[model samples]
Target: MAEKEFENKVALVTGGSRGIGAAIALRFAGSGAEVFVNHRKGAGSSKAKAEELQERVALMGGRLTAVASDISSRSAVKEMMETIGREAGRLDFLILNAARAPFKPIERLLERELRDLIQVNYMGNIFCVQEALPLLEESAGKIVFISSLGSRFFNPAYPLGSMKAAMEAVVRDLAESLRPRRVTVNAVSGGIVKTDSYKVLRQHMENLDQLPEHLVVEAEEIADVTAFLCSPAARGICGQTIVCDRGMSNALQRF
Candidate 1:
């Protein structure tokens, strides 16, 4: 096997307590990245789950810390970034993964619901990038936004898709502006990964079964691409959204 590529490096993954986020955090830990796992509030963050993950990473001989913060709040993001600074001193990777949405059609969403969706999914990502920039500057870090197929395809039930698409645009802008600072930015647009979020999606989508088994990706598969985006080997790739859907987007129906 290969050596731990992330040895001695440090990373922060938002929504790191569960699903694709948890998988990403563990992959970083497995690669020897001291990870700051950020879990959000309400139905999002879970202290118990975070603690469990920390223990598992510890067993792997890697360090991991779980911090509960509302990514939609500037103050919370600041506090979390500050804590990482004091303890870790530097940050090598920022994984924008924490997100909240009603998992319903846009027409069914209330005004407040739409506002909250934008706040947590779009603005929250900006808050993390802005606050974590100092530490990222110190480490000349990398940022990987955990996007979804909804960003590109028609997912009327998935209200959060717009925000994901918006962030992908931001990645392109940031990639150019932050180039002088050597802080690369990118995104991973994942397929239908069987996560808790998927469970919610299932309630709204009638054609979930239309997807073939081969096209349905695993959480760890997305994690693998995320980790690669942070690796030295990906230095040349910037401002890009690497689609990891196993070709699910390539067709409508199969024989």
Candidate 2:
């Protein structure tokens, strides 16, 4: 692929301040696309990381703009899309990578936790899609949701799985509904990615360290596949959730 394959294009990645979202932002920016990295609205680690990502992209001669928004709020999402339009004029890719949920069983979740689980992980992402629809349709763009194996398999304390599952269903529905408009919708179900959150998960699922080295999936690997889904190569694929888990999801394993 040419270094500037996405020249003049624009992409927005939610939760792009760190981890898989950060990698995806770098991937698109590295390919010469102007990227908008979305972080939750606040000053703290998330904002710091977004700034760091911006500097890194600048060092690489890539363009990135950090946008702050709480996707759970429809009003915030709307303002974000408006900002992107006013600044970038067009959007070619929308990566639904933002998610927020506590690590705990569904049955044990408190009222607040339950609301957050549904609001941020599920409704928040859907809100982005709804807000970005106009720009996407104008550009006939692509949308990719960042999902996980938790959506299919039962994890020790992963209530987030239910939301991922729901978003995957939305992906299917949107793919069909947006087909005529040439807006493609898809997802990537990652497996056991060693992100910052992994440290927290380790406390609950001690066996994560026991998985074979070869089974570990890198953030960049997921980003590469995500880029493919947004490229011309994936024009034929729609309403599909591609699993980029390094075969970890193929069968049961003894830890």
Candidate 3:
């Protein structure tokens, strides 16, 4: 791919202080896009990660800005959008990568916990898109949501899965609704990723070698796909949940 595929474009990645979100922000910066790395908190490792990304972009002669905001709150998201508009004037890509939910059985979860998950994972995404729609439309941009295979499979029974399923539906509906405006919306559903969020699951599973290579998708791998989806190369794709699970979903069979 050309180095300047995303030249003159601007991207916003939520929860971009570390892990997959950090990787996505770096990839965008590498591709010559001005990236906004959004984190909910501004302390400790998250702050360090943001600083590291800023340094990387500087070394690469790219543009990167780290913004702190809680995506689940409407006022915060509004403020974020306002900052982007003021600073960059327009947005070419929006990656909804912030997801928060406690790991627990459905019965054990309190009503507040479930609502929080829905608010952060589902409504947060909706809010980001709602706030970013006009800018995206102006730039003919794309929106990518980082989803999980849990939405399709039966494993990892948590309230998060239910929220993911609902979010996928929203992705489809939004894609269709935004089609007329030349704004594309899609979800990249990944398998078990090696991130802090997966530590709990890793403890229960033994013999990692038994899993397919594709099943262990990396942060960089997902970041690459996200960069592509934001580029002109993915203009033909829209309203689809592209699974990056290394055929894990296909490998499962039932009689």
lDDT of each: 0.92, 0.93, 0.86
Error of 3 at 105 (Å): 1.4
- Predicted structure 1, TM vs. truth: 0.96
Residues 1-255, model 3: lDDT tens digits: 665878899999999988899899989988888999999887888788888989988999998999989989999999999999999999999999998888776788888987888789988888999999989999988999998877877654456778789888988999999999989999898877788777766554444436655467889988988888887788888888888876667765621
Worst 10 residues of 1 by lDDT: 40-49
lDDT tens digits by residue: candidate 2, 216-241: 89999999999999999888899999
Candidate 2 clash figure, as a count? 0
TM-score of each prediction = 0.96, 0.98, 0.93
Specify the highest-TM-score model's number. Answer: 2
TM-score for candidate 3, residues paired by index = 0.93
Q: Could you say which candidate leads in lDDT?
A: 2
User: Comparing 1 and 3 by lDDT, which wins?
Assistant: 1
How large an RMSD does model 2 have?
Answer: 1.2
Off by over 4 Å in 1: 1-3, 42-45
lDDT of 2 at 11: 99
Candidate 2, superposed: residue stretches over 4 Å from native: 1-3
Residue-wise lDDT of candidate 1 within 103-140, one digit each (tens)? 78889999999899999999999999999998898899
